[model samples]
Target: MDCVDLTTVLAGITLRNPVVTCSGTYGFGEEYADYCPLEALGGITLKGITPLPRLGNSVPRLAETPAGLLNSVGLENPGLEDFLVSYLPKVRKMPTAVIANISGFSLEDYVQMARALQVDSGLAALEVNISCPNVKHGGMHFGTDPHSAEEVIAAVKAVTNLPTIAKLSPNVTDIVEMARAAQRGGADALSLINTLLGMRIDIEQQRPLLANTFGGLSGPAIRPVAVRMVWQVAEAVDLPIIGMGGITTWQDAVEFLLAGATAISIGTGNFVNPQAPLEIIQGIKGYCEKHGLTSVRNLVGLAHKG
Candidate 1:
């Protein structure tokens, strides 16, 4: 009888739709402007930034696999001041929601960046990259330990005035444990399953393909794992979930929604099909219309019904 309601809100920010572009893939919401209209999608999660500028990993930073891609891009960015001075002003006026992704090797690093960014800076929310290794802790990953994850999230939450989204790492013993830790630390929402730890080697050179040796894996190859994590975490965690990691099509996006993601973010999929989000948005509407569902919310976590 009426158009399907596509709007969805996460972390207090209302999105035009439940589709978002993952950070580190979308370049500050401009690179894809010529291909995908910025206004058509839900939000854009800008590339991850750090307190200081980084050159990122050296050459051979990306490798292609059958159904995926591996990257060791490090956290290369223009640092905090440069982003504030140059980027923030532009993104604030973007048609859709704009989210800032922050990465750090220490709790202080996260806190420092958190202090600088907020709704006033034109960001709808802050996605904390706790998946990064904690250099202050003998190289152990912060997302792997419940205590470390909680402490880091709390520190960032305390300093940042914007909504804090804890981006969980999939390379953990228990995804639920990390989700709970972030909640305990007062996270506003959760982005489930960042890239999984992976690597590739060149036979001729007899060395690792990525200069950093290990890299984060993304794309279709990791879809099943990502969906599983979203399903598991949604069943246990109470916060809104942004499901990602290998969503290349409308079907994949719907799977995440049914698994309980309040929203679905497209990452490596953009590289494969720059227009994927537009296609997905249309497809999702069609799906809702066919099912006689009045809103996208009606479809979320439907699979959990027994």
Candidate 2:
């Protein structure tokens, strides 16, 4: 309802709602424009972009698991230049905020992409994807180590004026340490539980299902892990969090908000149902109205109150 305030402020950038399309799943905002109104959702995170074009991982990049999917699609995208010239213009026209997702093999690579995007006035923020598992260097490596994570965050912050969000990896000894590192490095916000490292084996062929052997696992199966990590990170750091992983329905989104995410991102849910994001947005509004809550922000971290 228009009477209910669903607006959420994430690291100073205000979102009309809490539902955002996760990067790597929602191409650029244009591909899904025909499926749903781009402006209706809170924001859209562009697919990961690097300094140079990426071919991504080898074939057999996707496989299905019990309640999730395994993907090793690397950070496949046109280089930064192509995106700026071809895609950014179209994204600028969208009514919703456009969050650029950047990945790199080195600290320099992250810095380069950040510096290049500084001139784009239409961009809302930069999501530093440090948890990409398919890349050999500078992907999960930086995210798993606090020192490396801090270096990458600090470097990008120095070169760019946009609010920076450090996307953290679940494949770590202590998720809280990683969250603290990002905050210490001056990250404006954080996105937790990128994907759990997993794989499937073709018993008949006696070989790994994915050509990349190991892939990031996502879907309902990982929701519990995602919630736990979000709760832990919330307790450890003061920065706002964009919670994702296995968030398919409004109920799932509510679980994330209760766990402490200021906002939520829909990933594999997009593939299952293109309208999932919009539906979840409406569901949240309905829930707030029925519960007599004036603002959606009141639902955040409610589980931590006890």
Candidate 3:
């Protein structure tokens, strides 16, 4: 049986396929291996890690929406030391590309984390989570402003020669400015449409649904918005994009690629169906065959052509 080759590269890191698992969704690549073959995935972004271990958010860290899930997991992970000593060695043995996703409160924190990861030869790349708030700089600063984004990206780039992907946020007036800023700061690739900031009210209980009051919105509800953001940024920059948000099937994946995404990440859908990535891989093959496409790259950015 002929299948569409899902194999693709992101910022020079060769992934086995295009169906990557987003950070903070899959826990770690090891967890998925119990349910399905980890090698089938393009790559896995480990949950947001800090320089020090995090206990994460309080109770009710997760809430469910129509077709997605909201999580304020608070970047829970065992810090860089623990990850290097334990997780990294285990992940290195897996065939899938491994990425270390990092979050920091200040510029120095980001640089420190990058330097540590830089010394590790097993990691395929580093995903700088610049969307997180800068606790020392005052309220909601990083994602909303290009200056903050550049500062964070520049700091990390100075310490690591490894491929760096700047993960941007959707909670901004213009995503292009931020994308360009990250690129200027030396980001090898851009990943976008993180999550739309949202709030859920429980009318029956007369309170908020989540413990954090507001959380990032994901799943099918945000796919269209994600596509638009990816399209807008794709036109504004030359860096490859790792597009994600509400991807559940091959058709959705194709839509993102058509909208200008170089690769797609399966987030909410992975939780609903552990084998979602495999289904998407198969679906993409069928779509390519029916359309007489020799390579999936031919379908990228078809929606924006004038």
Candidate 4:
């Protein structure tokens, strides 16, 4: 307990711990201050930012399955100006590294969002979400094409000098190719696997459960897939990997790190248990101490023997 260290890396950025609250789930960094010590966790990725304020989708945006959740959050956000003026200042006051997650409808849109965030005071980096299905364009629903993925990454990288991470979609047939394309376009790091495309049918209503016929599936159901994708991309790219999917416990976070992920993010789990991230951090520390592991670094990539 006294000698274990949980510090980890994400795109050359060293995190004090491997536990991060995924974007959207944690809201703005300030919202979780009461739930968890802002400085104790690795980092917080702010809700997806857009060029203009969004109202988001209509009613019935979220649905829960047996072991997963379906969502079409529509990337609703307060736009760049409001976030910088209102949110960034408060986030900067916290001791944790604050990451801004940006989404766009086109390459130009992504560029504008990136340019706006590059000058923000408290942000540590920008995570380009190309895998959001709730959007009309530019998200993974459009990023499945390798050319489009590369173009989007290149366009965004051209405008911002901040460390950029391209969040990859799990819906692609060849995840490694998309990861490689992102790197070729100058992605400083990569995060996988954003929810898989899926749908839920309401037998009583005789229609889709979510307002959007098809939503992204996230939670324990997708953990194995996310883990495998992270392993594959870790082997395929030179950049650091921010692994996430259905992680709800410290053991899950440990598995991600073992699979080559530099850091881990908890998404849907946050909705079920607000204290899940804090518990995970404690669990990792306990594991390291009991096993006599001095630093968490020795665990990364331990599962990829090849």
Assess every candidate by TM-score: 0.97, 0.98, 0.94, 0.96
Cα lDDT listed for each candidate: 0.90, 0.92, 0.81, 0.86
Worst 10 residues of 2 by lDDT: 115-124
TM-score of 3: 0.94
lDDT of 3 by residue, 1-306 (tens): 355555677789877767788887888687777766887778888888888897866658778888767766666689988988888888778788888888877777788889988635688899998775312242236667899888888888899978999999888888999999999899999887687777778899999888777777889999989999999998989998989999998999999988888888888888888899889877877887897777676667777795
lDDT of 1 by residue, 77-169 (tens): 899889999999999899999999998878888899999997788899999888743123321377888998899899998988999999998
Clashes of 4: 1
Cα lDDT of model 4 by residue, 126-238, tens digit: 89999898877557754687788888889888888778999988888899999998988889998888988888999999998888788889999999999999998888788
Question: What does the lDDT come to for candidate 2?
Answer: 0.92
| Rank ordering of all candidates by TM-score, starting from the highest | 2, 1, 4, 3
lDDT of 3 at 257: 87
Please tell me which model should have the higher lDDT, number 2 or number 3: 2
Which parts of model 2 are misplaced by more than 4 Å?
none
lDDT of each residue in 210-243, candidate 2, tens digit only: 9999999999889999999999999879999999
By lDDT, highest first, what's the ranking?
2, 1, 4, 3
lDDT of candidate 1? 0.90
When 3 and 4 are scored with lDDT, the better candidate is 4
What is the overall TM-score of model 2 with all chains considered together?
0.98
